[model samples]
Target: MNTRSLLHHFKEMKHYFIVVVLVFGFSFYLGWANSASFSHFLKDQLAGLETVSKTLSNKENPQVWFFIFIFLNNAIKSILIIFAGLLLGVWPLFMLVANGMILGYVLSLQTNENTLSIVMKGILPHGIIEIPVILIACAYGLKLGMLVWKMGVQLLVPPERRTASVEMKRILHLTKPLIVGMVVLLLIAAIIESTLTYWLVHL
Candidate 1:
């Protein structure tokens, strides 16, 4: 990213990071709260079981084929997230929240009975990239969505205001570049997350 883009990104990202830190702190707090509960032990066991199920499911498929599928899915999800931004302001917020909740739950569960280093080795390598990319896409979509609705309040010629065709074409023009850039970034993240990151943790 250029200096301008970098600055713009940080400006956009700062609030989101605040939310993330809150989620992180929340996870740690939840872990402590659950320390004495049977619920904690149960949920931890369930998470482990789910992880094993996922592992077995992966074992049934060739790794290359799985990665190919994951790559396509990542692109599709990014596109949907971007497009969703155009319609609903809170859609991206929902997407980000869902992502955050999963990570939070995982982190909270980690405190039940596992080494921090092991958890980091397992999660952070690709997560460091993948999570932020998802958040960024959601943020961009949120901004775009906000603009689409807010910009519609004023009309230049009353009834002869911007036509649907003109507005849609303009939105497409702007959205194309973001979509392409997001897809490329997501693909790179998928590759690192799927192969390199997993291997680092398990191998």
Candidate 2:
């Protein structure tokens, strides 16, 4: 689809997108507020990520491997969450909460003096794109889940009240362009994360 078409679709789904963002924000707050409570679980999650980081860093062509790993991981997860929303949209929302909480917990670990530096150099470079892309994907997933839910509800209603199928088709069609756009943007984000962010953090 064309850029204008994609933008239009996004505009139409702004509410869903906003919902996804708000949930993440709230979840982040929860994580930050209850850092101690979440410490154990979050630490395990971070440890896994750290392991991956170490492995990637040890690779001969670490930068290239990092880019590939980051892109594939984000892209695949985002795509899966979107389709998985068919199960009442629970998975996508759960993922957002999990991710947001982890982020909050991580930031809570940073000292005040270095927090800004870490965010600016270690995250902002690629996160500006990656975060939004993930949110958009989740929004689409939530939308799909809602439609499926509506379809279930409409089973008892009259045929004339059944619009879920049409909306489902519309969303399915839009996914083509959405997936393409997400992949392209994620590629750019991964490159920046693997190269610029990595360099900045180490420097």
In terms of TM-score, which candidate is strongest? Answer: 2
RMSD of each: 5.9, 1.1
lDDT of each: 0.62, 0.91
Clashes of 1: 0
lDDT of 2 by residue, 110-133 (tens): 899988998999889999999999
Model 1, 76-181: lDDT tens digits are: 8767876787885567766665555555455655544575765667667666766666666676666656667655754534665646446545555655666667
